[model samples]
Target: MPATVIVNARWINEARQTAGGLRLENGRIATWVNDRMGWNGEQLAGMPKGPRLESDR
Candidate 1:
């Protein structure tokens, strides 16, 4: 499976971990990306790209 970059992902908690993106690989989370836009506002590592997605809490 190819790695996926989930942008516009916000983790609201005491830790305040603003996980810009999540790198998913092999059916699991591979790593955390600090850049929400996915590497200089563009896709990197050959991950499929998509528009920013957000949800109300």
Candidate 2:
């Protein structure tokens, strides 16, 4: 699975001066952490019914 990285932001309960980061996998949140809080993915599932990507145009 491919992974995406995000930076330069605060997560959870934290002061405005704090910063945090996150990682995403399979279009779901994988992990999130900051100077004050942290979290990880438990389960991620896609919608059973949704618009097709090809029809987005």
Superposed Cα RMSD, model 2: 15.2
Judge candidate 2 at residue 18 and give its lDDT.
25
Candidate 2 local lDDT, 1-57, one digit each (tens): 122211212111222212222233332323332211232322212222232223222
- Model 1 steric clash pairs: none
Indicate which candidate wins on TM-score. 1
Q: Per-prediction TM-score, please? A: 0.15, 0.14
Q: State, as a TM-score between 0 and 1, how close model 1 is to the true structure.
A: 0.15
| lDDT for each residue of candidate 1 in 1-57, tens digit (9 for 90 to 100) | 123323233223211222223343322332333233334312434434333344212
Most lDDT-accurate candidate: 1
* Location of the lowest summed lDDT over 10 successive residues in candidate 2: 4-13
Q: After superposition, how far is residue 41 of candidate 2 from its true place, in Å?
A: 1.8
Error of 2 at 22 (Å): 10
Global lDDT of each candidate: 0.30, 0.25
